[model samples]
Target: MVAKLRPYRRPAIILAITAIGAAAIFLGRPAIAEAAAVDGETEFVLNTFAFLIWGALVMWMCAGFTMLESGSVRTKNASMICLKNIGIYSIAGLAYFVIGYNLMYVDVVGDFIGSFNLL
Candidate 1:
């Protein structure tokens, strides 16, 4: 019987994982809802905590990507790839500080596009 079901094992494992994930979401709904009902100060603290946690996760992801790229590329070019990644991240941060915030938060009057003026 086990041999007969061997071919189906992959799908069975996937289905099991999906079922466990579904069960977790179903079970955790109440806690999620409760967290949504916080007061102003509690909400501020929660939002700040969430942002810090999210930022840490993003930093970890950057490191993971750097490692993965360095491992996949040729040895001679690995350092260049790491440098490019660092440069890209730095430029992205600079762009966000210079233009991204103004584009997002500043109000616009046109139907499709925002005002060209920077805040």
Candidate 2:
């Protein structure tokens, strides 16, 4: 016979969550957070770390898409699916580097769009 969990659920869940939250709060502080002053160096480090994390997440997301697309296709076509996924990601990044970079870094030449010069 299965023991009913309902009676213990409230205390058990609260204890588990409290333990996890305490651990996270106490253990998740990095060296940067310990800095005494919020200086340019700290700002720079935080920005760089944030960018690296964002890039890693984007790469992981792309990999997931590739896997999902490949798995959805027939075995014979999976290779094509993988290739297309990678190609699309590559082209999209390149396009962003060209257009989006220009949009952000260069002055907007047109009111609606960004710099058209191919970089």
Candidate 3:
């Protein structure tokens, strides 16, 4: 019976992973809704949460790109490509937080950009 069941294991594992991912997203919905409800001074919390979620999504995309690149590239270049992608994400995130964010939101002399609040 165990030998007979082995061939179907891959599908079962995929289904299990899919179900777990779905459950996690479903559980997170309520927290997102609650964060959205906050207003005024509490709005910053919501905004921060939104940014964090966006960053997480970007990180996820980076992971996918890393996987695709590693798979498509030659064996000799696979490690280098993966490392380059990782470095790009690291530098981009750091630069965005340290300089780009400030430049975009701070030192603005016109209405087109935001002011330096550092909230």
Q: Stretches of candidate 3 above 4 Å error?
A: 1-38, 103-119
**Worst-scoring 10-residue span by lDDT in model 3:** 110-119
What pairs collide in candidate 3? none
Off by over 4 Å in 2: 1-12, 15-37, 40-42, 105-118
lDDT of 1 by residue, 23-86 (tens): 9989967776666566888977887789779978998899899999999989999999999999
Q: Relative to the unseen true structure, what is the C-alpha lDDT of residue 111 in candidate 2, on a scale of 0 to 100?
A: 51
Residue-wise lDDT of candidate 3 within 1-119, one digit each (tens)? Answer: 99999999999999999999999989767676666555665877767788889979988988998999999989999999989998998899787877678766466677456554664
> What is the Cα-based lDDT of residue 98 in candidate 3?
74
Each model's lDDT comes to 0.83, 0.82, 0.82
TM-scores of all predicted structures: 0.59, 0.59, 0.54
RMSD of 3: 7.9
Residue 41 lDDT (model 1): 84
User: Model 2, residue 109: what's the lDDT?
Assistant: 66
Better of 1 and 3 by lDDT: 1
Candidate 3, TM-score vs. the true structure? Answer: 0.54
Candidate 1's TM-score reads 0.59
